[model samples]
Target: MKKRTPKPLVAKKLIQPIPEKVEPIQTEKIENVYPLNQMIEKIKTDIGHSPDVIIRELKIGSKRVFDAAAVFIDGLANKDVIQKVLQNLLVDVRETELCEQAEITDLIKNFSLATGELQVLSDTPIDFNQLYDAVMSGDTILLFDGSPVAFKIGSKGWESRGIEEPSSEQNVRGPKDGFTENIRTNTALIRRRIIDKNLVFEPIKIGKRSKTEMTITYIKDLANEKIVNEVRERLSKIEIDAILESGYVESMIQDETYSPFPTVYNTERPDAVVGGLYEGRIAILVDGTPFVLVVPALFIHFMQSSEDYYQRADISTLIRLLRVGTFLLSLLTPAAYIAVTTFHQEMLPTTLLISLTAQREGVPFPAFIEALFMEVTFEILREAGIRMPRAVGAAISIVGALVLGQAAVEAGLVSATMVIVVSLTAISSFVTPKFNLAISVRMVRFIFMGLAASFGLFGIIIGLLVLIAHLCSLRSFGVPYLLPFAPFVLKDQKDGIIRLSLWSMTTRPKLIGGQDNVREKTAKPSP
Candidate 1:
């Protein structure tokens, strides 16, 4: 028999193929008028008969001619508001004469429901989706017998954290109040700062199951329409089961997924958000999260603090320069040290080199391993401090770092010089104003360290070039990440590395702010 040819083995798929999108199930509408009992039962069935779903039945009018019932969630709807609504229907309706001439539905909506704002769900065929959504979202639903429509009373109330000074973005002198978990409260805070009628908060609903409330806030004239539309389009495309935090939305809507740098800016401070808005950027406020997300973030935006604009221009400029220096120091210090000690020992002074050599003489590992060990230890300590309870977290981190450094040096696992370098690197990383940016730096620092260990100074220079190219290529919602530096706009340079005097810097960012870029035309003030 002829020798059989060997057959090749095929690899099986590790991931299952994604299923095609399924059409949403169409819910049947409640055609015609539903009786009071039937409507209440239908609602209870749809929303589930939980203990929190309260349905109270009562008679309307003096003669009890009409049957009525009120449905609301227990904790979601304000008890005081629900009580007032019931009083109007029970006591107030009793006082009014029962007349067939006046429609009971109109009478209840016009006089009986004494609430701030309400919507009438009047359709030829009642839509149960609206009814269910209203009931679940802290609205009181009023059902009347023989009425084709239902009354949706706005009674949204829930316990939430009150406004306090933001812990993360604290400044020496600025607005003390910050954004709260309540979306309405956050919008109010923004509105209080900017009284302009042109400032609009357009509402949108996201998340299939959670039905999270979100708003796209921007100044109509100042913000570029294209950017606003782009933001809306991106947000509308997010199809998720739930949006528990702003970060979820940020990750979904951001332009770059693989880049270490943050394309979107998030903050708890309302002033920071308002400041972005003034610069023609858009702010997205998510319900139940104090942190709001600002879009079209540039590289310089993360480095500059809200405090920069609040202080004297000279002082702010100096501080910003210092921050820039610290940022570089944090990113390159470890890599520089590793490169110098490993391959470029000649770069150091004779005495410094002698000291470093003496310090490293007792250590067994090479420069790369020593630095990596110390960096990883510091990262663990930092993470522990953050995750631990606040009362002892700072103490634990401080004592842990000092004790571990001492023990490691004594044991010769790492050298004294390596410990000092790591300490300086950690301290410099904290100088970055934005936590997200700082995290990006922390992550990139390791790559640079690895590069330095491989090819010394040449590897570091190549890495820096690649990093700059990557940053220049990044686009945040269609705007360049390095807005002024890459494009080299002379007018916008005032706010780029160094912030010029407020009056001297007359225009908003060229690409971000729309054509109406003249922020102020005032001449420089003279002493």
Candidate 2:
């Protein structure tokens, strides 16, 4: 039999050609420069002539010689700033002699504009992209009829929710101010806390269509330059159309994408970001998001609270220990219950075993199903409470949980002991300070529950081993997820698991802080 040659494989055409390199926005200078009238028309057309966009034509430099226009968005640009610019150009310029040959751009930039923050778009031909970005970002733009240059005055203003106590990260003894949606306000809050000149806020604009503003802030002297550069590189690689929230940037720049655990830490408290910055961590603040992302976040960081540093060392240590214990309880309680009741009934004492057995007597399902049903029900009620309207949300959650749990117990669908276990677990889960970490625990709980159901107590141990291994392998911007624990940094022990006295923590975390790790050099205080 003659073996026929295999048919030649057909090469398939790709739907889209992949570019070898993705370029960052605003890199290339726009060469197309149009005259004043044509530029105004282009702006109107490009911006779809939105009613909110206001363009007021006026003459500048006395004698109405130099024709100019003030362009800005009505709501975004501060009305006062626009008025000040108009006054300077329209009213203030009248006193000066009309000069046709004088440098009007220089005159307006130097002597006319009252704003503190202003930028000259260009000396020669104005970059339209920069001009468009300026107007869109709430800056009032000044255009001249004959000159190619333009002025971008910092006039960003929009109605934003005032800085209020963060609902999610409330503390009894710490500052009440939290980060607002405005990026500038958030940076100011941080700056207020740390007035050092070394503290830096490097700005960059991301997203193609959204052109969302972002800042990567870190102390130049303390932050590890390698980590900062890694963060910068990752962010630069992002080529998205829009970044609606900090979460978008977090998802793009995080080290572990598929892991259930969050590699990036986010919080609404400005104090928290300040603390992270002091610890040599870089914070990524995105415009329009109250939650700021802190990088190279460790497992211990999530377990800690800003209040920890505010309170006495002993009290904070005790509270932190309680939190760690409760976290374990929340993760292991249901799984332990399932394993003991299903496979190792011998592990329970005679009296408690008999009581649990009696409770399960009326229940039709196995221990695993009973626990799973109650946990899921509680989670549903919790989600409902959060999503529902504020006035009715809490009432609905409480009423729903009580009614559902009581009804289920009465109907013999779940054991009373199972309900108690689930309630304890849910309450314990809330003890976790970081919402993202709590969510990770919640998701891991189910896996442990499944493992317990299949292979009993042995399965739980195996699951925990795998979980720890996974966490050990994770990194947040090159820093280990379980820093100071897996790496065993003795110096960082002062602030890990339990925080020592403030003076005792003389150095920052070895892996995170650069060579300049000495935080303080004072001796311990004593009376």
Candidate 3:
């Protein structure tokens, strides 16, 4: 009976309940903060008794209005700075206008606080947030206990290496001051060289977690806007957990992630980064890393050093050619050996071929096997040598080289020729200025060696084609990785592979795909 009654009456309409419009809770603003003392007390309370943010009360004469305190990070701020600024504020500040009270800053600097020098307003002008930021950043903060605002005077005294010649990129003649981890010092070092108002240092904060301070140094009219935009865009696109060093930024902003070639080049020389800026490219400097990043970097740039331009053109040209040759050798030597021994034996002269065969006669493995074994062993030893203490690294490298080669040859594990080939390959990889570039080449060298072993000359061709295709596809800040070449720009060719006479390179590279194409107006050739 109950079921029959329900069936006759129940008509259910599907209805969803709408969420009630809750009035947004408004945050209450501080209607009126206490006078300096009360506000300071409130700040102290909020600080929850942190050791670094200290408050000390000191009396000045009979007025007793002069209450001052210092705020700074424990390690970042110097005691001498705190003592100097505080001492100056208390006793040195002269009342220039004869107003009993004067602004705090005038006294500390060349002038004492004048009558009109310091004025208090209902609205605090000096950014407390910014001042606190500077304080946290190794700066000293002077808070006049009575004043609503605090003055943050920079007292960042950090210990770093004296300007020394870059060990990585040694030069014969030039400023020996390589960049240090201190950004201000590095910027100052660069500014010392470029006595121009156009040299602007634009700072940007990056890294969501690291919050690393990065600077974009560029000449006003010299740097192309398109490239600048590209650089900024790529950097903005970087979403990472941290950027501890310049390498982290380099990895994030490179043109091609998978390509063996490097799209962004790094240097320790301030002149080099400045030179890149002059060329209308963007340069990035990270706070903790001395290495600076240069974008729109071309393949030819790595073959060059700051010393190259400093030296005679002829000598520089020769050295640059040697570098290029070394790069080729490093990437191809092991592969060439495998190719010749496996299938291209006719390419070698009869005597050399006979000598190689003689060494290989007792070897149990094929040429590919021998080369791979030697190459891997050398890579392991090289890595260990690098990781070991510097004092013993050289010794380890020497011993490792000798033992790996001699033992392998004697054991019939690898041919003596293979040992020589792999060893030469390892040495040649260092010709590139950047260690990252050299590392990438080292990795690809093995791939080419593998290809060569499988199909000899054919394998080498395929491997090179793959590399070229990948490079051509890569773009660094919108510039092609194989730029000014591969695509074959005849005008920009003057600067690639070989550096031409100064006048000959009057025109800037186009495939750099920059907004500005001219390095100079009329072709004034370098004699």
Q: Give all TM-scores, in the order shown.
A: 0.93, 0.92, 0.83
- Candidate 2 accuracy as TM-score: 0.92
Task: Compare candidates 1 and 2 on TM-score and give the better one.
Answer: 1
Clashes by residue pair, model 2 = none
Task: Compare candidates 2 and 3 on TM-score and give the better one.
Answer: 2
Model 1: lDDT equals: 0.87
C-alpha RMSD values across all candidates: 15.0, 14.1, 14.5
Q: Model 1, 89-175: lDDT tens per residue?
A: 888874345334456776777776888888888875678887788988889988766566678999999788999999888789988
Worst lDDT run of 10 residues, candidate 3, spans: 6-15
Write candidate 3's Cα lDDT for 115-187 as tens digits.
2222322334334545545656677655554344455566677576677778788777776879988888889
In candidate 3, which residue ranges exceed 4 Å CA deviation?
Answer: 1-32, 35-56, 93-132, 144-147, 239-242, 346-351, 511-527
TM-score winner: 1
Decide which is better by lDDT, 1 or 2.
Answer: 1
